[model samples]
Target: MFKKLSVLAITFVLLLGCLPMLSAQAAGNATAKQPGNSNPLMDHKLGADPFALTYNGRVYIYMSSDAYVYNSNGTVKDNDFSALNKINVISSADMVNWTDHGAIPVAGANNVNGSAGIAKWASLSWAPSAAVKKINGQDKFFLYFANGASGIGVLTANSPIGPWSDPLGKALVTGSTPGMSGVTWLFDPAVLVDDDGSGYLYAGGGIPNTSDPASIASPKTARVLRLGADMTSIVGSASTIDAPYMFEDSGIHKYGGKYYYSYCFNFSGTHPAAYPAGEIGYMVSNSPMGPFTYTGHFLKNPYTFFGVGGNNHHAVFNFNNQWYVVYHAQTVAKAVLGDGKGYRSPHINKLVHNSNGTIQEVQGDMAGIAQIANLNPYTRVEAETIGWNAGITTERTQAAGGPVSNMNVTNINNGDWVAVGNADFGSSGASSFKANVASATGGGKIEIRLDSATGPLVGTLNVPNTGGAQSWQEVQTTVSNAAGVHRLYLVFTGSGSGNLFNFDYWQFSTGGDGGTTPPPVSKVEAEDMTLSGTYAGKITSPFSGVALYGNDDAAAFNQYYAYGTHNFSVRGASNNSSTARVDLLIGGVNVGSFNFSGTTPSVQTLTNVAHATGNQEVKLVVTTDNGSWDAYVDYIEWSQ
Candidate 1:
């Protein structure tokens, strides 16, 4: 949505087919395998290594979040180790808008962040990739990644964003592993499972693709292994791939019964090719372990359309029978800091293939691919799950606990909002809205808007204080004709103060637009009210108690009563036409202020008083001079 009007308005007449242009003079050509067609997609935070999964009509992307510290010149400072402490998951039905599901927590730990600031495997924590498999009739996700670039580690979880566990309890493939003797550059792990439930792993680096030539070793290899059914260990010995100009970041996949192996290639003089060094090249083979035929360049972004960061890594996935390429670019960091060292983001584009099985030269995109479906808002949706946001950032939900994540977007100041794009309200339409929220201080209002932010106001639910930020409660409000396709915006409006409240999740219902279900409440009479302290000197009984403006601030009410309410009617009257003010006190907190300056001496009502639910002392204190500061309380009552 931040794109220029020219880019936004331009409709691309994309070429729909890829031609197999195999390199005729290629070195190390084995046998031709197959040709193929194939998001910077995220905006909340920067991420790289787009391991894409097309599951149940949705694309779930796993990413390596860059937590780099850059200097004034844009170069990373210190040890760039901390940024890879964790990984994150984002998903989408449509290609343009994506939902950030927060950091993917390691099952037994907090988003890979352990006690203090370190993770169990901090070093090999960069470039993440994963594959989903079904075991025992249920789907399971196997996540593979490099740990500090030293070894390959695997985590197994039931869901993509995990409650995960270290499957092997150590690096699955280490330098100590038999065939991995001189292959020191073992990182950027990619994993995929085939139609028959068989899994494969691709990894290796260090020797040829390093910026520092000294990091290259003698036996630099791009290694592939037949993963066991468990997906944690190798089935047998690893096979070596002798691809011409194959560098780091090996991406492998099976499409149309053909296996495609892709990697980064340098634009060096010795390796003459169409795509430059900072782009990508791929080869194909009939077998999983490729005695492969080197294909020409497939992807090249010599000058990043997103910005200036190198090291091309990518993944190809399909949804609704259409193929796509997901790659990382260093755009946001460079655009923000004037330098893009140690930072990168993800982007996606459609890939079309020729009848001969060769992939089209897929280019990068800015507005990105099309969204296949619309989001539904009548169901319970996670608050931390966002398509896009403004003036807000995600944080730990609380101290990391069992299933409750430490990663929920908090610190929502006034005028801030989060958008859930293209929510389908269905044909019936929605009549109401409900949200789970908590406030440490008091509360605020949630303005529900459809389509654009300043569009129609569907409803406004006034959120009440729920003890603390971690204390959760559900509040409902009414909505109007909120039907059809539109972007759902949860706009927070409070006293422009500091942090207002923490939001959990929200849902719209066809009914219950009449506010929340009523809670048990009772009415207390004036004579039934208890009074504290001795104020007889300035007080007299008209029927009950009356008091003149007190010279002393301490001497006040007779007794205290306990009560709780969101709002209630206070039955009382002011003494005269002069200005009369009183503070309604509850639970050692000033619950409300009532001004009956010009009202007559009749039973009156005060409503919508927001206060906590608990039995506590309720005392009324006189403030300012107004007709001897006297008012009679008949009965205090509330519906909920």
Candidate 2:
């Protein structure tokens, strides 16, 4: 199972049956305040195409899709995809403590729309919408999804939440409308049921049409077609609903005699400088079927409440007479030259329309409003080590047990080392701590112990040193059997006797519930390389030796030599991808790998054990997915 580790503080609050009326002006100015609610009524991550349905007096917000894996250059990061691609439902009766209904509309499940595809960058599923109404006078739930590359599919369930399935292999809209012919990219299907039991499906995110006057040559426009009473097919010519800056996922709401079309504009694409950061915008149409006008940038900013990036891809809906806007954003620093892909988060805020008539993007994060039981034993922190012989200190200052800070080894220091010991973490259990380290220095080793454990011999580990310093290798260990406010110490026991071997910071974890399950290792062979899928050039290792490689500068690569984990030598080869992508595949399945983009590669290891017995066929694949840049594999290894 994929997991997401968030660092925000957690809290809980009981919801009273009241919502404070938001003022339009105040709502627009309601920047996310610091020390905000821990669990705001509705907030999501990497979420898009948000669809909301009020059932049995409770409100459930569903996202059409979300994604966890982030790719840069050619390196892929192992991340939680539960919040993306799969369907997640969060529900609340009092607007607090929303329940996560895991994944619904799961691919390949009974009644689901399509078959699950292989690990493609943007596969699985996309935008989702739900419609609940009386079918033959009995209430039924209709779940709509955009499956595969472009087809709009449908599923049915008895309950609002569902184990929805689509027995038919093809999409209803594909067969119903003649205009949706050939292979086309039309997704994000929003279904609106009319008074007479008929419904219209609004499909969006298509290439610009040049024939129509209203058709702006932008990647945002909706393809509208009415559906028959059975909801099986389209009812008319594929009429295009064009709007000013109106492109991408859109929500259609019928209000006081007019149709309010809320659409998302790639605010990042608005200016040449802002061509990558997306933001939400809105437009209004007197008729859901006609011309719409661009309103304004709903919520466009350079930074997030978490000091990351702004939000985009929104959905707005009404629950019990209250209108709410749902969207996504990233809470991390962004890349200047991205892979043309945007980072996102799911968000919800009460919709406050201006007296003059306009809608704003949701503001004031409610993520701070709720509390959930934390299952993690120890908190994890990511830190950077700079300069030569750098030391990061983390004294036990909090009530809980954890490392005070992290240490990184970026400069070559054959004589440098780390010193770790405990300080004021009031004595608890036999205070157990663990450290995870990575380097390419073959002879690197770690000497660790608690001040209360025993003699100078607490726990010592020697890094397997041999591979080129260009690639990073890793070692994970747990040190225990200590008492009192135990001090855990980490000292690089030099190549032999002195602090001659330098290293990155030793990561410390106290009382962490991190599972002991090791990651799976995928084995690949040199024969697996095909001209189509393989990186252009290759490295022939002389004799029996292991090679390593990554996207790192000479300075960072040189520092690994003093760590004594793997050898500090590395060879560079050409490839392209935002990050350095390392792949080890067994039967074409990726098992061990490391990915790095923009910043220097994180100190980690890709473990492929086939080389241990000298029976492994290794094929290294590099990527140049990003258009402008290229790089090389850092090094290789020979073992037996």
RMSD per candidate (Å) reads 24.1, 23.8
TM-score of every model versus the real structure: 0.68, 0.45
Candidate 2: tens digits of C-alpha lDDT, residues 1-640: 0011221111111000101111111111112211123322322223444677766444566664444344676543333333334565655433432434435634543423345421122334566777876554235677776654456777777666665655355566653466555213466677777654667777755334433433433544466677766675567766666544444566676666566665544321233322222445555667555566656555543244434442345566765456766555443102111321233334566676766776654454545322111111122212121100112211112112222222233232333332222222323432233333444444565555444223354456565553433233435555454334333344444444322222332333344332233222222222223322322433453311122332221111101111101111123322333444444332232333434343332333421121111122334444322332233444443211
Worst 10 residues of 2 by lDDT: 12-21
Per-residue lDDT tens digits for candidate 1, residues 342-418, read 45667788777678878888877565665444555654566766655555556656523313344555667677677
For model 1, the run of ten residues with the poorest summed lDDT: 13-22
Task: Write down the lDDT of every candidate, Cα atoms only.
Answer: 0.60, 0.41
